[model samples]
Target: MTTLEKKGSDGGGSSSQEAAARRGPAGPGRFMGGQGTEKSKDFKGSGKRMLGLLKRERPLLIGVLSLGTFSVAASVAGPKLLGDATNLIVEGSLGKAFAGYSSKAEAVAAQHGKGKGKVADLLSSVDFVPGHGMDYSAIGTVLLWVLVVYLVALVFGVFQGRLAALAINRAVFRLRQDVEAKLSRLPLSYFDKQPRGEVLSRVTNDIDNIGQSMQQTLGQVVNSLLTIVGVLAMMFWISPLLALIALASVPVSVVVAAKMGKRAQPQFIAQWKTTGKLNAHIEEMYTGHALVKVFGRQKEAAEIFRQENEALYASSFKAQFISGIIQPAMMLVGNINYVLVAVVGGLRVASGALSIGDVQAFIQYSRQFSQPLSQVASMANLVQSGVASAERVFELLDAPEQTADPVTPERPDELHGRVAFEDVSFRYDPEKPLIDGLSLKVEPGHTVAIVGPTGAGKTTMVNLLMRFYEVSGGRITLDGVDISAMTREELRSGIGMVLQDTWLFGGTIADNIAYGADGATREQVIEAARAAHVDRFVRTLPDGYDTVLDDEGTGVSAGEKQLITIARAFLAQPSILVLDEATSSVDTRTEVLIQRAMARLRSGRTSFVIAHRLSTIRDADVILVMENGSIVEQGNHDELIAAQGAYHRLYQAQFAQAVAEVD
Candidate 1:
């Protein structure tokens, strides 16, 4: 059996056993053991938060508006110039398309004699300059004006793009920094209830949506709205009756777009949520690939992945389909509006009721108006998605945080190496207390061992002393000072914890050892490593202390990783030490090495050892046997064995097992 199993068999083995069991047959789809028991409340008041965020960035919004207006103005000027050019060409410059050569006096008298204005009356109003060919110079002047207008329009286009790009980029950069800072300040409980994957999606994907909306769609929407307004006004100026018919398409398009956008927004949000979930499943599958193969559950894992993937695809399709239709439908409506205006204006020009210039200008204005409308319809989809993502981000930002570490916290004048828990009680959830009204104390320069069955709160006791969880109904003090009054960083800086679950980051061996004390010298690191028995192994490596390790030190054995954690703790040299099943992963021989190091480190500090192997703590000043959430016995090893109580019974069982192994 592995040393980890042996350690488990000796102390709190059943709890670990149950946890391992849950990793297999009973585990939930990719999100098993890490879920918190408590459910998070549904997020609320998102609009208020959004409004607040916008208010803080009012300057940016104003800048977008100003630039967008300028772009629209330049755009509008282009059509007017083209319309004037067309008018110049269509007038006398084209040299009388109609073949009638009668003067205005003769045509009007002839029309009066015929009782109503005949076609001659219409032709008479159109200046029939006798014997004059087309004025190409006038046409050239109009064309030149149109060309200059287009040139300025191009400049405005470039200006608008640059301004929008710069402002949005700067604004979004600042926004992300602010959001990240807010995340850092939030209490641990905020992370506790969320899957790491989902939280990261909000920080990354959701914000990316907002950026897309701003940088890609936001300016377009604004310019489009302004264009629509300007176009409508110009249409009205040309002919109010024609303008009224032209704008009939606007209300219909707006209603249709509003209905579609409302339906599409929720699906977009749901799509993002499912994508996050699917990514979580994929991450888990890759991370636990070895375990999946070892257990021969590959087929089951594949089915689980397929289901999540399908769900994400379905949501994405639904969202995109609805949003995608808005643009084409809007263009269809705009086209109809344009066709109606052209037909009406052409009739007015044919009847000599409007000038060719007026008809041409109205057509240009109508297109300008309808084009912005179409743009708005397209941008509506993006804006809705952005709002949806914004809502999710706001939800995360508004979550209730765990307790904050104290500000202006007390700092100790000197180190005493004493720790105490008085009437301490704690519950991860309020309804289920793990440690209930329990009290314990350890003096300076003493080694204490905690042993218990599964769910006996032995680890909880150590956690309380370390202040990972605050006590629900009591006080924990270090050196006779209440820990709640001290800053968490200050309190933690004075305590060293060596957990069984070893985590070694990717770095040089020396760097990993000195992680606990940022600026330790080479000699100090070597000494700590020697004390932890990793120095002997380090010297044998190709790079000695400079050997780089993979994440969590995959290059090293589990036992070696545990030793590195111990070396890190030793280097910290805190007033209080916690060895939480620290030597559990190492073999018996390596445990002996770690035990010797523990003895040396415990000489002048208050130390708490959660021991599974009873032999390692034979010299402990105090041994506490815990059952359920209460202490069943406490005394020196010899005294507990003499009493033949809970501790005595457990020790004999392990001893008998050891003897049987020898045989």
Candidate 2:
């Protein structure tokens, strides 16, 4: 068995798995090994948009085009120049073959004495130097010219490639930046609908595909086109008859390419789509490997992975195989053209209509011309695949952004954290209302403890207050000002949130704690750490506050991770606090320290707490018991207990559960 299989069973993850445990900012994360999930690709539209994107590098693109043109033009002159040298050698040799004769007529007279022979007719096209066996000096000069022209072409080609790379890199750089900004503008709810791996594939893999193809195929595409034009022009200049013969293959190449291209395009799209599905599967399984192992689902995970891998292979094979046929098919047409051009040129030379040197040059041009056609046909898969990837990236860029912050926004001169919801209504789906016409007011400097069973919309209420989701109807206000009238940034500025899932990036503990505030000092980080009871455990580690941690906080336990997050929130020192089971993760000793900190943190501040642990809210100034998105009862803990309502039953159930766990 493979190491992965031997160790664990971990199936993949997907948007399907993200059935949304956390509604908004902490959106849904589901497990379904899936990748390359995209809609029908728009090849033409994406190609156009990609072109438009590159237009920003207009001057560089134009420069590359010009250099490629000059380069190809210079290269096309090489065979003809070499042909001149060949003619020089032939003229000198024929001069010796027809020595004691000054002209073709004299040569014909000497050889046939009556008719102009085909050899003599061919010789008639060149002016021979009688008795000069070969003009070595003239041949050398022609070779030098050939060398200079080719060298110049080489220089231009080198610069053209460099400039092409520069332009393409710059364009891709801008594209990445646009994608980054687009992600920021997208609403939190948008992520709930997308698979994490698929989104990642679009942002990273698809964009990378675009960059790679543009770098490798962009300059080559332009150069191949220019080479065809230059070579065709040279072919016609040397011998229009042979040029027409070479042109015979054009319609065939075009027709074949068009047919094969249509077949290949869709396959490329399918290939990328399957890739995304596979990546999502891998990402999910890897992340949830431990769970899979504990459940002995490794065999199941492996089977799913194999299925996705097989799908990817099938798609990739079809795409490559279909596109691969074009190049060889184009080569077949080119070879036929080569034979026709060669035969025709030879006949023209014998007919005295062309010199042997011009026929050779014309034949070379035919080959050169057909070569570009084949080159272009060979690049079909790359072009199709790149455009498919491009469409995915464009889809991301074009996703509808969140509603913009209001212009001429208003905020209170001073915030007292008096928050109120005035008949608010909200639902993730219109058919299923989650919160409807819910109304409440929390006075400044009071702790409101929200207690409820799962799906009671406790978290949803806080999310609305945080403005992660706008209310479908009615308005929420703070300090007599509608929050909608305030920028999200400004409204969130005075609030600190510590969620059930603690997020710690790959950085030092000090930095993670300081992330709560802008440019917090070392002293402030240590103070916050102490308040959250993180300092004691942090000091037990080798590096203490300076100790580094992974994004998952791998070096620490789950409880420690939550403590660090609490410490971060403590440093923020906001006027309002949202703690979502913030104290539940820690040990009993640490919980005591955190409770003391929380008591101090709650003083002179409006706070909302979501807790399943009923004991924690006993000291809250007011306990709001919510059920089905409505406040069934609200009062101090003792008052709610005396009323014998939903809050009382919840407290009893928890007390019983606690007693059972102890037993």
Count clashes in each candidate, considering only residues at least 3 apart in sequence or on different chains.
Answer: 0, 19
Which stretch of 10 consecutive residues in model 2 shows the poorest summed lDDT? 1-10
lDDT of each: 0.74, 0.83
Candidate 2 lDDT over 1-663, as tens digits, reads 000000000110122234443312221222234333334456777888887878889999999999999999899999999889888988988889778877666776565555647766776778786666887888999999999999999999999999999999999999999999999889766776676788899999999999998888889999999998888888878877788888889999999999998988877888887778678778878878988899988987887778778778877888899999999999999999999988888888887898888888888888888888998898988988889999888888989887789989999889999999999988766676767888889999999999887777888788788776778999999999999899888888898888777788899999888887888899998998888888889999999888999876888998999888888888889899988888778888778778888999989999998888887778998888888777899999889989999999998998898899999
RMSD to the true structure for each prediction, in A, is 5.1, 5.6
TM-score each candidate.
0.88, 0.94
TM-score winner: 2
- What TM-score should be assigned to candidate 2? 0.94
Residue 262 in model 2: shift from native, Å? 1.2
Candidate 2, lDDT over the whole model = 0.83
**Candidate 1: RMSD to truth:** 5.1
